[model samples]
Target: MKKRAAFLIGTGCVLIAVSASLAVNNQLESLKAEKSAELLTEAFISRTTVFETSVTEMTNEPVPEIIADNEIRGADEQASAKKPIIIDGQEFIGLLSIPSLGVSLPVNNDISYPLLKMTPCRYFGSVDSDSLIIAAHNYNSHFGKIGMLKPGDRVNFTNAGGLIETYAIAEVLTLPGDAVDEMIKPEGWALTLFTCTYSGTERITVRCVKEERI
Candidate 1:
């Protein structure tokens, strides 16, 4: 009967392990859903006043180029004329919407673990400047489905100042993670958002250009 008792104990342990794993998975999904809801509410409803205040405060500050390494690059006289509005308490630039992909997420000015888990990040450039490069983790709700975007798809960038810039997708390409310098360079005014592939071997880049301002 000793062997029989051991088998029953082993079965109990296996059942306990499976239950714990299932609980953890449910919690993670709940957290993801909660975070997405928070972003949608913040992007569409709240934070409008906060963004306007941020714009006023940063209106005179220099528009520093934020490179891949977060270094301030050479000055663009034209860009410097506009203010860099990402303030201490108010780091979010605005909401980025790709209707085709059903992506409507808040955009933080800086890339960090806490910020990325909550929303996409503006790694470099700005809405009013030459190029804007945003990044996100390859979650299904984030930039994971960006590969499905085709040329001519519309991408909307809504700034804190209540201004919306509509962009037309121009190209979707993949590049090595080491190509930070090349990625930040703008051929002209454009918007770029990237996420790593599932294997993390390369970055999938979606490039868009301003088609209209509203």
Candidate 2:
């Protein structure tokens, strides 16, 4: 009888331990989502301020210089249009927005550890080129839900100078996890957003193309 009581107590302790662990995990996930959302909000506000200010300034100035023949105008145009937003010494290259996902995050050129967690980053290629690639973690509030986006969904990109460009989702792909190099070196995709799949065995890729420019 004593042995039976001890076994029962041990089983109860194991169950309590498991319950506590599950609770902690759930709390962590909730906190992560909240933090991701907060970061995205802050990024949007920051970029909006920069964009508006640049637009106001442009209205008062002469038209920008003409591009020379044979020059790559896409990247150069962006560079000449507006100055970068410096926050805590970090420069945000652009703004990425997807209304369907409720995401508007800053686009930084660098994808360092903590920075990516704060917001999305341009992992490779140029937004000016047809193969721009952006990446972020699959946090609950981050790019985790990008797979829900379907063809014809809209995605907006705002460069540093307040130039807004819109794109329509062309394809949603799940590539092998080991295809990181291939994913970054896109062929003709205008804009690409990627994150890891839930099982970490695949990469979710959302491709978009130019639809409108404002």
**Which candidate wins on lDDT?**
2
Tens digits of per-residue lDDT for model 1 on 88-188?
34466676778787767767777887667767888988776748889987776778799889999888765654455678899999989888876887577
In model 1, what is the error at residue 35, expressed in angstroms? 2.0
Tell me the lDDT of candidate 2: 0.71
Error of 2 at 156 (Å): 0.6
Q: Relative to the true structure, how large is the alpha-carbon lDDT of every model?
A: 0.68, 0.71
Which lDDT tens digits does candidate 2 get at residues 1-214?
A: 9999999999999999999998798568656755864765465455553354322222223212221111444676556544556666677777777877776667776888777767778888876676778888787566878999999988877676566667789999999978877786658778999998878889899999888655
Q: Name the top TM-score candidate.
A: 2
User: In candidate 1, where is summed lDDT lowest over 10 consecutive residues?
Assistant: 62-71
> At residue 5, what lDDT does model 1 achieve?
100
